[model samples]
Target: MLDHDTAPTGDKTIETAEDLSSIAFGFMASKALFAGLHVDLFSALADGPKTAEDLAKAIGVPLNRIVMLTTALASVGLLTIGDDKKIENSPAAQNFLSKQSKYDFGDYLRYQIDQQMYPFLLQLNAVMKDDLSEDAIASYKHWMTDEEQASVYSESQHAGSLGPGRTLARKVDLAKATSLLDVGGGTGAMTISLCKEYPELHATIIDFPNVAEIGWRFISEAGLVDRVRYIPGNAVEVQWPGNQDAILMSYLMSGVPGDDVEGLLRKAYEALAPGGRLMVHDFMVEEDRRGPALAALWQLQHMAFTPEARSLSVGWLTEAGRKIGFAIDDVDALIPAMTKLVVFSKPA
Candidate 1:
């Protein structure tokens, strides 16, 4: 199974079977990961390593389940079991997934499993039916409303704990970045970070009306009302608000599928002033599909919805952006995180 997981495209039959296996066990893997995250297993291990028996007692999981979790984590390269049966985070885990790590993904996983996945599971049939159930509608509205804004803001801000956004944000000369556009910047996490970095930078945040109300309050509380404008509208039909020196695209593309993804990027490209950059931040896969367990698992989540829209490769993105006349530059794996940042620029 390990060999098969690492295999590239040599055997078509094996490749097809592996692909199916990945999809088949994808849910199981996701549940295991979320379970580990929920119980603070990674954080406990972060202080140092321990035996699964020790960990089981520490986290209060049964010994059987701890063994199962360890086996699954080891298979995914997120944990290592020594000869004496002590367990520790693999380098990947130490860097990106441990709750104590500065670049931790615990909050992001919590958001997905607790908020999005749980609710999405309940509304799956409705979503498939082209239906919007009243429960889902009410949950969404309530989530975005003023009363729950703090929870929304906390979740959104910490949700990027797994993002590659910080690296992309650093590579650019923000001094020249006067006007920026953050389309669908949930609760203004990315927006606030950029605003703080570039004193001259002003930003427009576009999100759902109720969500934008939360964002407005946040930008105001941060004393950035003068620098950030909240614009409430549907990202799908809204015209691209122009004159941005750079467009922040942090973790914003995966939820959009196929043509909509392309359309959104096209709009963003056109919205940029000449020489402006589109800072794409996401769990980008490697050129050759192999294990970067979190990213591979994330690809499954992407595929769960639209078959055509899986976690994309930065290499593929480069080629695609080139076709659109943008120059792809400074692609890098954001350390201490799961994703990669690929900065694409339109010529001056």
Candidate 2:
């Protein structure tokens, strides 16, 4: 009943009901954030504070929506409102969302927006109902052939591996390695990163032909053609080329179901020569597999090949490797939660 001008400044009417309603529409906030990132609003703010009018000119967001959008971001703490009403990046935003910072996480936002993740957001029920009937996988084939789609997914993984991968790669002596085969090696991030670090390393990227073409292009861009080769084919049906020292599977397992995974792992065991290694870098959940919520959630999303509903665990790999005649070694937890690097080796 109170008029805005006459009312006291406060969250006077907000209640749990209102909060619940907000939660329902929380997706609006996500879309707005995505749009802002797409327009480079955060990167723009990275330079310094800017008034609404100034932001409009710099980032090209609709002039009218600027204040509303900026205010929303500020309310969420991604930005700060200065004394003069100029807005700037919040500390969190600067460290993670700003493009200029190497620790920047702006790409995190972009990947969701640019990828088919948005439609899925609107159609999650359909997605949950075994409903890729409407061409759902067109944009989100967990094993996508499109270079850009795969790159988006892989870069998201890179961001996650950021703190951990760097430290581990530096600490681990992959220099003794001779060869590696990266299954479904989209754009070759793991292989490329490893090879770039170890001069003695050579790798073969195995994936669908269309996907391999993209990985090849990316490898050429990195100028590592001499060190890595792309072998395009399906991992399930094809016999993985053998006589390799190591095989790297990064974030590829969870996408596949258990029976399929067992088949692939069996193939991997056969593919390795005596004393060779199989590197399974993925979400290494706890033994009971109750915690690590994301990994648990991912198991549902990755309904491929009808994998056992039980999450993939370190214990699972260690035991499974022994069964396949490969001794598990170097199975350490990598920095990013839900990702572990387990080395399975054939007996000499």
Candidate 3:
């Protein structure tokens, strides 16, 4: 009897099947990570390995649930179960996931990815069926309008942006820049990073009122309060401080309507002094909008929420800047294949 369900592939069958399964059940992996982060499991294991029973008691979860979660976490290689039946964080997990680690991004994973993005992704099918143009779930405007939501959004984004901000600080030379205008700089992650790197540089971060309030706290925490200032208002409508040595617009364009991006670029052009630099950092896709899989997936995720959101291509941005009296200086990947930094300068 021939089995209709199983298709015969020669040597590649196992690999192909595994790949397909990984894609199909990918949410399970994401959820597992989210769960582990939510419970601060890595932090609990930071001191040493612990038996599942010990972890359950420490975290106040049932032993059975902890056992199941540890199994899942081990499967994902975040932690490992040793011969002594104790689970310990993988080196990567200890370094990046533990709350005690300076590089911890667990909050980012929890708030941004798990809380904010995951719910909207659940409605991908409904969004497709309705041909939704605006956010079918939680709109960006609605989120920014609420005080609590805005704070949560800004803080989460700040946590996620810190790594890229550090990378940008290292890669981009801001030694010559004295003043910088950070447009829609939620929570001032980039500003804090750049200001910390350049003693002479001072930054003005413009964002909505609520988000700006949070940015103030972060700036104060970074001890860059003397160097960084907040300008609270709608970025598009506000009068941007002019004659700036540098302007940074990171992760802003893709959230707004496509038509507004060119206008914003024009604004950035006018705000810069002669020879002043402008940097646009965001998730950019290729002109064909094919896979660089992360950018493609991120674009779809944006579509699931923001109606005006679409992935901007580097080609489009370069042309747009040229038209606005700016010259392309450099294009570098801030996070390889995921986000990019496209730099332009006003002719001196």
C-alpha TM-scores of all predictions: 0.66, 0.80, 0.91
Rank by lDDT, descending?
Answer: 3, 1, 2
In order, what is each prediction's RMSD in angstroms?
6.6, 9.6, 7.3
TM-score of 2: 0.80
Clashing pairs in 1: none
**Candidate 2: what lDDT?**
0.69
Give the worst 10-residue stretch by lDDT in candidate 2: 1-10
Off by over 4 Å in 1: 1-23, 113-158, 161-163, 213-226, 239-241, 251-254, 257-348
Worst 10 residues of 1 by lDDT: 1-10
Model 3: residues with Cα > 4 Å off, grouped in runs: 1-17, 129-139
Better TM-score candidate (2, 3): 3
Mind sharing the TM-score for model 1?
A: 0.66
Instruction: Report the lDDT of model 1 for residue 89.
Output: 89
Candidate scoring better on lDDT of 1 and 2: 1
Candidate 3 per-residue lDDT, tens place, 203-275, comes to 9999999999888999999999788898898888889989999999998887776778898999998899999
